[model samples]
Target: MLKWILRRTTGKCELERICSSYPAGAERTRAVEYSLSKSKLAALKILLVSDGLNASDAANNIITLKGVDITRNEGFRPALLQCLRHISGYQKLVSEVTRLQKEKYSTAIDDHEQQLLKLWSLLKPARSRKTSKTKRVGELGFQGNDPATDFRGMGLLGLQNLVFFAENYNRSARKVLSESFHPKFGYSFAVVGINLTSLILELLCKEQLKSHFYNSVSGEPSLYHFHRVYCHVFCEFHDFWFAEEPESVMEFSRILELYKVHLLSRLTTPGMRLHSEFLAD
Candidate 1:
């Protein structure tokens, strides 16, 4: 019989001391875990050195990493499915914000909002190379508003109807991002958006299957115990799905692949905001 003398922890981590026991042949499993953890740390170091991931970027990514893993848990099929949808919805919000911020498009959200309004434009293309007095044109419809051809139509009925839902997620990520601005802003965003988003996420998570369960209880749709991680990721996922993401959102997916199966997973790390890291620095 053999016993490991110490519990595992990162060498630089503040944690210290433990009793660790494993099956006789569990060395291989232990090795894989150690290797994976080391790799994550190594990636962080490499990114820090080469990517110039300053204190703020490092802090943001860490907070963001917590949000991204929600959809990766395959075990919690229902929650995972809902998160996937939220992620897609949120990505749309990302594009909107990014488009509004570019040097070429720097303006209020509504300014470019008007430019993109052309869902379909009337055209005058003809087979005749020679042009004379011409009769008026052909196909015409709004650009993004046209449900027939426009990818993002308009309203809930439009191609981009889901953007409305995604907007909630963007608001969620903004709270996380607000750590860069002010603690009050971050807290404010979190409280306001989560209160609303929790409802939205709860609905999205339960609408199909859970809704049936609710029908029997209150004679209306209701979720009994709310999901915390589901809401966190729904916010993070949907924000990434619709908002102006850089590399942070993509990074979270990579981390979630590390965990094993379960009913649904809670966030491995408690979420953080810029306020905490900013204070740390």
Candidate 2:
């Protein structure tokens, strides 16, 4: 085969050639992903599907199989290890996100109730605490007297995303919540947050987030990284919603589609990383 001929003539395997040729981030990570997916060896192929794969052990397997000389090819090991970490980390993230998505929010669970209350406290610190069952939950932008019903679609993941944003980016979260109350451009803050959570979960499930994560995180992507991405998307959506200046909330579906189109275009760009200017402080 021409590949075998090139391997012998160049004295390096495809992965090594890829590492030496391409710089780190999306391009190199994607190339390594493609190479592993096409590899004839079972070990290499497993790397594409397996979760929690040890990067060092995976690097050793590749080195032994490809006969890479560590002494001469100093960069190959580190490069391959990073790629493996990103690959495995993405898979693990998908699993964890999916698990959260499936977990239904339960009032019987004390932790869920506490997390829900924490979201209110972070966003509405000026207000006095109310029992979890109070109709006041609507002030945060739920449709009815109870906020728990909104979680039926996105499950516990929705609550977690909202809480993470409010807890970690308190100022930005409260700012967006205030913007959502604008008389003309007013929208449901909590509802929009839940919708964005679903959008992000869809992107993650489809593996459309690889480029962003590859460029942003140097190592394994965790739930924290995933939450940060949600925060970025939420902030971006807030700006996008007001910029559109629709006639009313009825235009939400149409506007959301337009925003999603814009987001997908950016995600496909090489080395794209989503970060909010609001987070700069």
**Cα lDDT for residue 73, model 1?**
33
Off by over 4 Å in 1: 1-173, 179-217, 222-232, 235-250, 256-281
In candidate 1 the C-alpha lDDT for residue 163 amounts to 26
Candidate 2: deviation at residue 157, Å?
1.2
Worst 10 residues of 2 by lDDT: 272-281
| Per-model root-mean-square deviation over C-alphas | 20.8, 1.1
Clashes of each: 20, 0
Q: What is the C-alpha lDDT of each candidate?
A: 0.27, 0.90
Total clashes, candidate 2? 0
What does the lDDT come to for candidate 1? Answer: 0.27
Query: How close to the true structure is residue 11 of candidate 2, measured as C-alpha lDDT?
Result: 90
Report the number of the highest-TM-score candidate: 2
Q: Which candidate's lDDT is highest?
A: 2
Model 2 stretches astray by more than 4 angstroms? none
TM-score of each: 0.19, 0.97
